[model samples]
Target: MKKHCMGRVVAASAVLVSSGAIAFVPASAASATEADCDGIGVIGVFKAVESGASFNYNGRRVELQNESALDRYSRAEIKSGRKAGDRLWVDRSFHAFPDFKGIVSDQSAKSDGWKMCGPYTGSRTQSVFNANYAARACAEIDGTTLCGKWYVD
Candidate 1:
């Protein structure tokens, strides 16, 4: 008597049957979708002008002008029985000026969407200077997260 294990491979997506039971393996599992953010409904939208950077949140707005540096903007959605949203923004500056400011917002409902913004500045001197800026957007729904980022130099 000879015993053999018979199997076949399909085009990535395949079904295996054994003992009157079947299981399926999908072709692609890692894909970017809206549910990447873990149900967090927060987004960050930022812009940079000649002087500084500006950010907005759910119709609420904050602007940093002249001699300021925007650091990071982040958002997260909380999964609860009712659902909620959270947002955070941070900035920094120097030279006898206190340029660090932090902003945060919370929403009562999970289905609600939120936004945030901030600025980014590089080093400078009397002779040579470097100016840079950036922006980002993020959102989450159904336990999925999505994000987009941009920069200027």
Candidate 2:
């Protein structure tokens, strides 16, 4: 159910930025549709402006901006379709969604999708999927060339 959410997209996209620090977000019991991203646990995130809104599938929004983390990690967001329409996530492949590079978490991982995003993290207390893919982030932060270790699933 998409409203005239372009401005909302831009507004949301505008806030897409990650702080160069770690904040362990606990995983949720089930998948969620809220912007809070209850189920999907985001390991790490950075200024992946190069990804170019990987969350947007065929122009529809998939992930919601992480408001608390300055939109760093585009939290996996599920929107209720008309009577729950079919999701295009079936054909799991890198080029499945040419314009998008979705995180493809948990179930989505079973099927091919875009590379993951975050830091190489771990959790002994519970199950956490950590991808070793390195995502180098080199962005100008406060007039300084900020570059360091960022991860991609």
Candidate 3:
């Protein structure tokens, strides 16, 4: 009886394949951040205000840049947290795309810190940047965890 069941299953699969109803096609390979790019290059800019470092998602590391900007942002973020309508900007020109920006909204506190959700607008790419209390910008694209910056802000 087990052999008969296996034979029937094989016959059914053969029939489906022959009729083109079960054509097997290889799934196209995707990179970790492919969804983040969405066919357009995406560059994430985050500032570690407390540390005076700039974090880029593309590099996945921190670099020293404008200390004044980092300090100011750090103070503001640590003081009152991100306010509604606070803007986060990304220069699409830098990434070979167009300009895209998002605003802070829907703020909530988590165990680690505060989380803010906002969407990027005025671009072909549909993406959102979530800011955390640790001063990191996080976005998950294509099953990949992308983050930028880490500080008070």
Candidate 4:
């Protein structure tokens, strides 16, 4: 009977967290200050590939550079893959990331012409300097748009 009671106590101790994670909170835990984190973070390295053109099949990355009050640049790097050669391309932006759902970065911010992804290179960059903006990376190929998550850079 004691063992069963202990098991029940232990089972009641844990809590579930968002992002499909499990956490254990002590029954004695006090209500502390509200958490400041919004739970958004780096989208990390990702891949964008299709039949006609495969760019960054191995890995692609979104980078935050020159962080400042007025000169930040969001870069997309096609780490490796078959050359995009104009058929495949990478795009990135600052301000809003893909996870925001209906919220998308300003269209004008995608200033780079489609030619941004050149046959000889695997990188392109765009700039939008803002204090509260985040980073988003995407690729266009074979009539499909693949986007990774976004994060506050």
lDDT of each: 0.23, 0.24, 0.24, 0.30
Model 2 / residue 113 / CA error / Å: 14
lDDT per residue for candidate 2 within 4-35, as digits (tens), equals 21211111111222642211112212221223
Error of 3 at 125 (Å): 13
Clashing residue pairs, candidate 4?
A: none
Q: What TM-score, to 2 decimals, does candidate 4 have? A: 0.33
- Report how far off residue 30 is in candidate 1 (Å): 19
Q: Give the TM-score of candidate 1.
A: 0.19
Global local distance difference test of model 4:
0.30
Per-candidate TM-score against the hidden true structure:
0.19, 0.20, 0.24, 0.33
For candidate 4, the per-residue lDDT at 92 reads: 29
Better of 2 and 4 by TM-score: 4
TM-score of candidate 2 relative to the true fold: 0.20
The digit string of per-residue lDDT tens for model 3 on 9-116 reads 111111112322121212211122223322233234323332222333222332221124222222111112223322222111111112322221111112222322
The 10 consecutive residues of candidate 2 with the worst lDDT sum are 119-128
Instruction: Give the Cα error of residue 93 in candidate 1, in Å.
Output: 16
lDDT of 4 by residue, 94-120 (tens): 233324322223232322211121111
If ranked by TM-score, best first, what sequence of candidates would result?
4, 3, 2, 1
